[model samples]
Structure formats: structure tokens, C-alpha cells
Target: MSRLNHQWISQLPIKKITNVKPVSGGDINEAYQITTPDKKYFMKVQPNKTAKYFGHEINGLKALGKAIRAPKPLYNGQINGDAYLVLNWIDAGYQGSQSELGQLVAKMHSQTNDKFGFVDNHETGALNKTNNWDDNWSRFYVEQRLEPEIEACEKLGRWNKWRQQHMDNMISAFRKYYQNHEVVPSLCHGDLWSGNYMFDTEGHPLLIDPDAVYGDREYDLAMTTIFGGFNDEFYQAYQQTFPFDDGLQDRLQWYRFFYLCLHLILFGETYGGSVDSILGGF
Candidate 1:
């Protein structure tokens, strides 16, 4: 308790970390709820060594602020050179179920990107997604997005070798599919998942911990459905606001394959068979 208290209070640019407590999160970083004369603030000590994300995290928070959705990044500084992040804690209490979540996330994604990608660079799971962009979604997705992770997975021995041929074929198929597809770079939460979203008191989603990127809007939308967090209502609401092509349903998998491979890399065997299965199906 003393060590954590010192870490939170003493290291903070503020003083008197009264009512300091741990905040639950699935992040590898440590989070805390601290009460001060001002108000409650959420603080996280980021893993500075393995974390290239702090810089991007700063940008993502700013981006989310501009979009006017998601939590705002407050203050961050180093304590003994380890990075810490502060965020205005919004009660991300669940406001609705699947469908509502779908709608809000779609709105968030609707916020456009700067040119193609931003200057920030970071890794998505174990894979290093390119900050560089091109006008072509299929080319960008294949060469920059999927190709790196696939190669990394092979190097890490986390890859499902059986799926290489499948990926090759999918790549070819997507090349043709992309030919007919319109390319637009939308601001993506980079990693939008059910866990990443929370409903505020007004029932609107306030997204947090983005791996923000500028990519095909579908990439963000598709990731929502990858592990099954959103529902049809979300899709419906999103379409009403920002409609997709008539053929999106038939083409959803085209976007989903990236994260499946990503999960296969991040979680190891739990994701291995599924990766092969998806590749096989393709």
C-alpha cells in the first residue's frame, strides 16, 4: 500500500494522494483511483520500457477529443522516468446493449483522418502496423497491415503455417474486391472492442485506450464484430448515419481477417486453431 501510495501521490505532479485506490483494468499498465481536494482522477503508470505507445497515446487522446467522443487525456509525466497518464474519468457505466454500442462506435469512426495516417507509430499487439498510408485500402491492408503481422508470427513461431496459402489466396481475392471498393481514410479507434467501449450516464459511448490509426473505416467496424461485441442495431444506426456499400455484408470478412491474425499473434494457441480455420474458410 505504501509503495503504491507513494507511486501515485509522490510521483504525481500533485500532492496528497488521499483515498488512493486501485482501478480495475485489463491493461498491462497499472491504474488507480485517487481522491484529492479537487476531485477523483484516474492515473495509470505506463510501462515505459516496452511502451512506444505513450507518445501515440497522447495523440490518440487528442484525436478522440477532437472527435468529441471517448475519454480525454488529461496529464502525463514521468516518475523516475516511467511514464504516467491521467484521464478525466467518465463513469463508463453500461448504458445499453449491443445495438446501441454499434451506433455510437460508427459515429466515432465517422470522424475523418488527417490525409491518410498520422505521424505517430505504435504496435498493435505484437505486430507493428504502418503509420504510412496510401490511397489504396487493399494495397495498404495487405502490404502494410496483414503482411507485417504474418511475417512476425512466422518469426515468433506463433504463426499457423497452414494458413499461408489461404492468406495468399485471400490477398489475391481482396485485390480484386478492393478494385471495386471505394477507399476513404476514416479515424479509427485502431482497436475498438466491446471492452474498449463504455456507456456514460447519457448512454453515449466514451471510448478509451485507442490504438488510433487512419485506415479504412471498415477496419474499425469490422474489428467490433471480430470477437462479437456489437449487434445489428449498431450496424443499422451506423448505416443510417454513414451508410456503407450494398455489398458490405458479403464483404465483412475482408476487413476482419486482419485482427484474427492479430489475435493469433497476441494470445498464442487459443487463437491458433481459429486462425487456421478462418484461413481455411477463405
Candidate 2:
């Protein structure tokens, strides 16, 4: 681990820092467990980024915390060309209730917005997202989400005639189906994969590292299905709490295609087949 600059350390609100140990924070940032005599905190450092790099995350945590358990953001700033965010530490625990987690997520999805988007645009890896507000969900999704990703894939030489044909078909299908269906602009944890959630010391589920947006709730549910951490109990509770509209299962595949396609752009051909599988279905 690179030694944190003394100047940077001094700028932090905490004092008498005793130890700083590395921790798993995922692929994007350098994570550390900060220790003092009386307290511990989780910090994420993004090299060469401005303080604004963590602005979206702070907004997300505040939004999610209102409806579900989420880490409390303490502070964020830039020093020595690295941007960092500090959050209240959550001790890891085993055996959190999946049903409770499901209920919490369902409650969170109930928070709606007047339009689809967020206060600011966000980024995943090097790719930037345009989250401009729009009244029409289909037009917003197709223009802001799908088109940008496809453009990135094309620039990377990952596009082809076959993919293009399927993509056009999928877009048409998505627009046509949603034209009749009324979709509420519900808040979503844009990245809801298994690794983004954890059980605290009290066995309570806590959401972390959100890429939040106000969009179709099914878009969030689609992320749950792509990974296997959530079980039958979780889905059962979610359905009981907030019953889904008919044909939700079918629409989930379309949202799944968006995430898989993003993975393909971020990680290359390993995810190409998964993206194609969804597109082929369309």
C-alpha cells in the first residue's frame, strides 16, 4: 500500500491516527480501514480524480439511507491529486436476513421522482453516463443509456453488423412495449450486484457503492437476477412488499442486456456472449 501523505492525513477531521490497513473496495478505488484510538472508518481513494468524483456517491448514500440501511458519509476531499471519501465503518458479519433485505430494497424503490435521471451524471470505469432528466422513460433509456454504451462498444472495435441488427431490433421492441406501459420513475441502485451489499456486525443488510438513478424499478430488479446472491426468500419478500406488474420477468431481460453490454465494454469479450444472449432474445 502506498503511504498516505502526512499533509493529507492532517487535513482529515480525525486525529491521532494509529493504523491504516488495506481492505477490499472493488476494482475502482483504493480502499483502507482507518484506525484511531477511539474509532474506525472506511475510506476510498481515487487517484488523480477531483473531490467531485465522490459527489454522486455521497448523494446516493444520503438517498438510500432514507429508506434502507446505508453507510453514513462523513467527509470527502482531494489531496495530492487523489480524491477520497470517508464513511462510517461497518463491521462485517455473517448471516443477514435475505427477506429483510428484500423488504428494505422494495421500500427504497417506492421513492419516486418526477422524471427519470439524477441530480448529476455518473461514470462507470472510464465511461460517462448522461443522466439528463426526461419525462418519457423509453426515450430516456434508449437515448441516454443504450445509445451511449453502443457508441462506446463501436469505438472499441467490439461492434459488428450482427450486433447492430439485433440492437436495432431490441431498441424497437423496448420502445414499442413501453409505449403502452406506464413506468414510474423510482429510485434505483444503478449497480446492485451482490458485492455491493454486505451484512453488518448486527446481521443487518447495508447497501454500499451505489450508482443511483431514478428510472424504472424493474431496471434495478434486473441487476438482482444477473447475479446469484439473492435467493427465493428475498424475491418472495420483495413481491409481498411491492408486487410487480405483469410481464416483469420478460422486461427484466432487456435491463439485463444493458448491464451485460456495459460489462462487455468494461471487461471485453468475456461478457460478449452474455450480452448477445439477451439481444438475441429480442
Candidate 3:
């Protein structure tokens, strides 16, 4: 709320400031669509009351900006000494009856990467995607992906201890069950949930506000499946395009545990049971 910042905001060439309303998006951040007479722009102002995590989000969005049907990142800047993101606003509609969810996601899965990992962005305050991008999914999953979370959980005194203390059992299941060969890097919208995806007025899908990265495609699909996004029609569509490996029942937790650990970190004990169940399965 500095005088200089207010003066600068007033300089934005807005035709008519129609409305600025709070749009409920996520628990951690603030979202709004600022409408003008001629056009609209999506606005995200992070809650200054908490430590900044949207830094990662901005980086993630930039990574996914190349997606065929996702929102384009317009500009990200600071106002009144806090962070905000302005993006291309779409006339997004929903389709609960549409079973094409899985099929469309499969199309998204077709989007690939150069190798694995992405070039870092400094202005957006993004972390470097530190992982071995080779074809080996398990080593990449355990060493580069899950290890960091497990260590952090231990540091935070969470119950990752059940698996961390007996790491061998988890590995045994992972090795014996899932048999994914070297998977090509499908640039993934790392956090794929119901909220991150939208359907435009035309029923064409658009994924927005991605926490994007490059990794095994299963990791992305696994999350959406767990959280109840698309229905069997979606899965059927995706299956027709590129069928998933059999025995998802055995290895689903192998991917899900990463997210479960994250929720445990972000939301605490409400997710503790899920973590326990995944670990207990092994």
C-alpha cells in the first residue's frame, strides 16, 4: 500500500475497471479475475500473511506455458511489496458429464521435453528441477523425487518414519511391481487437480495455473486419478490413445506416496492416514 506503488498501479492502461472480485481457487493463495471494458486478465495475489511458495508456482506456469491449451502467462510482477501474476483469462466452463477427461489428458501427456528437467528461471524465483531425466523411472522416482520429500518429512518430525525407518520394504515393492521402462519425458503439469484444469466455452480443454515439470507421465495421471477428476470415459479415452500398464493396483501408491507426503507436509494429519495406508501396503 505504498504511495509510489499505488501511483504505478494507477498507470496501468485499463479501459474501464469493471470488477475485481475474490475468486476462490486454493487455500494457500488468492485468485481473482480483473475485468476491463475490452478484455479480462486473471490475477493471483499471494497471501502475504504466509511464506512465499508462489515463486515455485510462477516457475511451474512458465514451464507449462508452451502447452497447446493452457493459459498463457502474461506478466508477473510485484505490487505494494508482494507478488502477483497476471495471465490470459479464458471464458472457462465446466463439463461434469463429459467422460473425455482421460483422453484429453492423454493428449497433454503427448507433450514431451528435450531431455528431462528444464532450464531454470531466476526472475520467477523457481527452483531448479533437480532429477535424473534418464529413461529409468524408478531410480528417478526414488532418488531424485521421493527422497527429498522423505527427508523433509523427517526433518519436520512427520510420520514418514514408518517408511523411512524401513526403507527397504518400500523399495522392494517398487522394484517388484511396477515395470515401466525408460519413459520419455512428458512435460507434466506437476500438480494436476480438478482446480488446475478447465473447459472453455467450446468444450475444448484448457489447463491453467500449472505447477509444471518433466517426469514420468504416470505421476501426473496418478494424482488426477486419486483426487477424482475425470471419470471412466476420460480413462477410456486415454486408454485408447496410450494404454496404461497393468497392475496399477499394486503400484498406484508408488506414485501416490509422493503426493501424500506433500499433503502431509502442507496440510498435516488429515493426510496422515493416506500416508500410513500407502506405506502399510508395502
The best candidate by TM-score is 2
Candidate 2: segments with Cα more than 4 A from true spot: none
Q: lDDT value for candidate 2?
A: 0.90
State TM-scores per candidate: 0.89, 0.97, 0.81
Query: Which residue window of length 10 is worst by lDDT in model 3?
Result: 120-129
- State each candidate's clash count: 2, 0, 2
Clashes of 2: 0
- TM-score of candidate 2 on Cα atoms, chains taken together: 0.97
Clashing pairs in 1: 70-207, 103-234
Q: Highest lDDT: which candidate?
A: 2
User: Global lDDT of each model?
Assistant: 0.73, 0.90, 0.66
- CA shift at 4, candidate 3, in angstroms? 12
Arranged by TM-score, best first: 2, 1, 3
Give the range of the ten consecutive residues with the poorest summed lDDT in model 1. 46-55
